[model samples]
Target: MVTKSSSGEPSSPLSHTDVASGTTGEVVDTTTAPPAQGTAGAEVQQTPLNIAELNAPDGNAPVEINDDDDSFDGDSAIGSDVGSDTTSLTSSVLHYKYENGRTYHAFREGQYIMPNDDKEQDRLDLVHHVWRLILRGELHRAPISKTVQRVLDIGTGTGIWAMEFADEFRSTTVIANDLSPIQPTWVPPNLQFETDDAEDEWLYTQPFDYIHIRNMGASIADWPKLVTRSLENLQPGGWIEIQEHAIEMHSEDGEVPRNTVQWLSEMEGAARTFGKDMNVAKNLGGYLRDAGFEDVHVDKYKIPLGAWARDKRMKEIGRFQQAYRATGLPHII
Candidate 1:
């Protein structure tokens, strides 16, 4: 199938196995691309949640958040109760690896550095809550009608988003695939999970009405090829949505601690050592347009680092982000 090159010109046809076999064309140097400019940072406001109270003494008991909070539904925000059951691929995919006392997926070993153990699964669900809050409880930002036919979710960690999306759009057939077969068998009738690698060629028999990719900034080796593959696998007038974040910390006053800066720099360098980029979030829009998409729109939201927002919703978002980042930093970096 024909795909766009780094220069936005039509490139020659790519074989189905080009990306997975590492036989693709030139890689896009995102570092050389000029930095994106816009409103400097995320807007912050006040909130009513008390950080100290949430982490109070006496074994740090759980606190009950108000159900009417504008941010997210208290109990319904997380995914359905996941059972220990797995897909039919369990026999081959169950060979998990262990390192430093942590478990990781054995399928496509070493491709994705992050662990897929229970701890990591919990973190994934927590981040899913953060996403729902950020989107104001919507499944996606793409302005597609509910009657869309088919959907695809790449890098479906824990399959939380995919499960919820399938439940919301019962008429649409949804396919969620990831490196690990960790998804629960108890899912909506419309949803199905698979064990697959997105970096490889997409051999989907039919095109999808919408393709959703999230939190894949550090897992892809060739972004251009991925964009091209998504383009080729999409039906005409289909929509593809990407949700990602730049892996750098910023302050409004141009002042950051030296140690923090150094740590972030080292983390980025580590990702490069594995042939991935942690800062592809800002460049996704350009990639889509260059791949021949006519209408491309971007919405950027800045999530604060802690419970420092004046708005209650923003504070909760920041608090959740703090937990999510802390849980991921040690393993991912």
Candidate 2:
């Protein structure tokens, strides 16, 4: 975990490794104090990240993520509209639209092309588990000390990450926002869900120590504005981390799968029709830098499509990825 002192200058680089990927270290920087209101953002200079072997062959058994742990003690709060001031929202918020035997959110209808039905929700949760396995049970890659305060989770579908984070960090207050109120009501006390949109102006009264965004590719319409809002609402020395997949798939031998390529091409074209970018991962670093983040870092991970990796961990991730893709494609289309 690399750090920056209160002077806004980077401190000595430190080594922090992830148990799953065995990443060499994380490159991070923080401004211990918030920038002055009238001050311009710092120059965008991103530090190079030191990455480790991502898909090396290993003999160890695959790490198992327990799905049972995600089960709540009470009855499942499925389809419940529980969020910040739920009563204030109009009935249209719950007036979902159905088409071609699938359900979509009514609050921001057609803004997001994906369905919010039970199957898609399950797939979302499955992908979340894969992410946990990818990071070896770690919630985020940012290097933050124990003195952290508030946290924000953007596009918190299913609210899985936010709930787990609130459970782990009981002291810190957590706020998660999403277009659909599909999050479960049986959640940690420290966490709250909000029915909000990321592309719109943020109206939070306080700054956050950390902000996390994941799997929002093809959903966000304006990346720069989102990053800028996040920057403005962050405390000095705070961190914002985005975890996304580069949409395009490739093979190690430089051979592309014909069918997969065709599918992704169509998906990309359709997303463009909606005025959204299907492939936003590769451009996130540039957006962050342009938003005035002084020290940005990029962590790249190679996720296999099937259980063909020689390493047990990679094989597990591939298997789950394959399942989610298979089940999710129809809903997304």
Q: Which ten residues in a row have the lowest lDDT in candidate 2?
A: 15-24
**Residue by residue across 205-307, what tens digits does model 2's lDDT show?**
9878788988887889888888888889886557788887776644343233344446567778888888898777778888888777755666665555444
Overall local distance difference test of candidate 2: 0.63
How many residue pairs clash per model?
A: 9, 1
Clashing pairs in 1: 45-309, 45-310, 45-311, 46-310, 46-311, 46-312, 47-310, 47-311, 47-312
Off by over 4 Å in 1: 1-80
User: Candidates' TM-scores?
Assistant: 0.75, 0.75
Candidate 1 lDDT over 1-333, as tens digits, reads 011112121221221111111111111111111111111132322122233422212211222232243232122223435544585775757888889888787888989988887778878888888878767777776766678789999999999999999999989999999988888998999998989999887889987767898888889998878887877777666667788766654442233334444655677798889899877876887887776664465555556444444467755775676566656767854
How good is model 2 by TM-score?
0.75
Q: Where is model 2 more than 4 Å wrong at Cα?
A: 1-89
